[model samples]
Target: MNIVRIPFSILLLLLTTSCQPKNKSDKPETPQIVKETVAPKVEISLEELQNYETAYFASGCFWCVEAIFESVKGVKEVFSGYSGGTEKDPTYEQVAYGRTHHAEAVEVYYDPGVISFTELVQVFFGSHDPTTLNRQGPDRGAQYRSIAFYKNEKQKKIIISYIAQLESKNIYGRPIVTEVSEFEIFYKAEEYHQDYEKRNPNNSYIRNVSIPRLNRFKKNFKSYLKEDSH
Candidate 1:
């Protein structure tokens, strides 16, 4: 499957945008960081992508979510972006600071012939704590809330059915607080935000939180992973 790679220069810019001054505790404060790097762009034809379907989800950090969906067999592209809110062209700073209601979300492109939307919903719930309200680990805010954005009635039904099944099985032992919202505009996050975990493998937050989250999902969903991911 085809995927986009962020130039190293863009990675530096994105990380700088995401970094904050180190606090006494582990979480970094929000502030700008500056660095430089570069890379070549690989293009995937539109005709190739027309055979795919799209799904939107927000479970925790986009970095973690992006990485998880990327490993799935049918998933062709996963983009870190902002959605589930009414902000126009929102920036990471605005969303993270609660200036806008949008959550950190990913736009997942996948082939339905290989994987169904039902299975994708299963992955979403399995990967993150859906019981938590407006929070995920160290990141806490409305923008970090759990949400499943559906493109149509059929997709919405799939998400609802999975949540109900999980609840009946008492999977989370708490009420699932995941929001089911109609798909609307998906404002692609800053260029630096795309493919974050892949590019910033050594970044502190990526090392501590992102990678562990991804590993846990990979272990649990081995059957759904791409060969290289395994």
Candidate 2:
């Protein structure tokens, strides 16, 4: 059998005790060893998703963003991916290291009837700090930059209007720097990244940063979450 070589940087990261990046570096490490516990299974077929509407957002680590959106009532599924850049089929390493312009993003499939696009925008802004530039919590890089993508003019108007309202209210006490871009292609992240928080419950990053961020969103938006999520 051919042995696959793991990059030294990646190996070192995995061996570290926390997913938090060292002060000298902004790379958030992940655990190399996967636990035996599996994420809860909830598979939605592609055919069934045809009736659902899609939204895309990038607010930080996809792991945290994915989990937050998944908890919402109408959200059908959330997939970690890269967006807001021109690179085609970019890898995690390329995006994570800022080698590609793409930022870590998520593709959300939700029922418009159950949840409106306006509400989804609210969740997007409510969950993460949009005022920060190219950084979220422990991860500090362009890949973690905030972005809200719109597929059409209507969606674009909604995002712009929300930002205006937030600015008017001075919600963050700073200017929101989130990017409002047109929806383009979305390259799904590697399989290991899918449901990462659920699968790696004990992971340092998951336990500390990811879970806390998710919990904060849940608390602030209690009515938006699904019953099972609580």
Candidate 3:
């Protein structure tokens, strides 16, 4: 994806608010009170989540990806996180600035009976430009790279098969650069990052990038989206 220059005023707004910004120094310190207030309420408990299956994906900014998945049917909860790296408990700064190998990722808890892993894989590829290496929209770096994580052989084959089908059909008109990797530990991002799009709709990055990306997904995948999401 090509980088578009934000207007000076919006750029200033992002510098003071966005979690992922063009410049590292642009990130501001979020207040603890703000974090507590903005954190999304978890509708499901850990015990109930154990009854559902979990899928992982890394496609650009988790803020956009998380919102997209949350709108999909059968997805009970979506979490913004860091994955695809060996670093332990990586901080947002470390991952955002390429100090760690981790990429911005999400943990998707879904009901397998309601939405199959195959369909979720479709949503993953459909939501973002997988052909763009180490970049998504205006964000650039390994931290923003696309990755589809599989927890077992069945899930792995499903992801690979879908990619093959896309390639056979020449879906993107370019080689799919998305990484298909085995599942690893996922470090949940700071509380402030959770449900960021919902809480910070006016944020420059959310308005300019995240919401637009999610709207595109909703437009294309209406059947996959929950009724309320429409």
RMSD of each: 8.0, 10.2, 6.1
Q: What lDDT does each candidate get?
A: 0.77, 0.81, 0.82
lDDT of 1 by residue, 148-209 (tens): 98989988888888777777877766798999999998988877767777776777777777
Question: Cα miss at 207, model 1 (Å)?
Answer: 0.4
TM-score of each model, in listed order: 0.84, 0.85, 0.86
> How much is 78 displaced in model 3, in angstroms?
0.7
Best by lDDT: 3
List model 3 lDDT by residue over 117-212, tens digit each. 988998898888888899777778899999999999999998888888888877777899999999979999987788888988877777787887
Q: Candidate 2, TM-score vs. the true structure?
A: 0.85
Give the least accurate 10-residue stretch of model 2, judged by summed lDDT.
1-10
lDDT of 2 by residue, 176-210 (tens): 99999999899998777888888888877787678
Instruction: Work out candidate 2's RMSD over C-alphas.
Output: 10.2
Q: Give the Cα error of residue 42 in candidate 1, in Å.
A: 3.9
Off by over 4 Å in 1: 1-30, 33-43
Error of 3 at 77 (Å): 0.5
| Pairs of residues clashing in candidate 2 | none
Give Cα distance to truth, residue 227, candidate 2, Å.
0.7
- Displacement of residue 94 (Cα, Å) in model 3 is 0.7
Model 1 clash number: 3
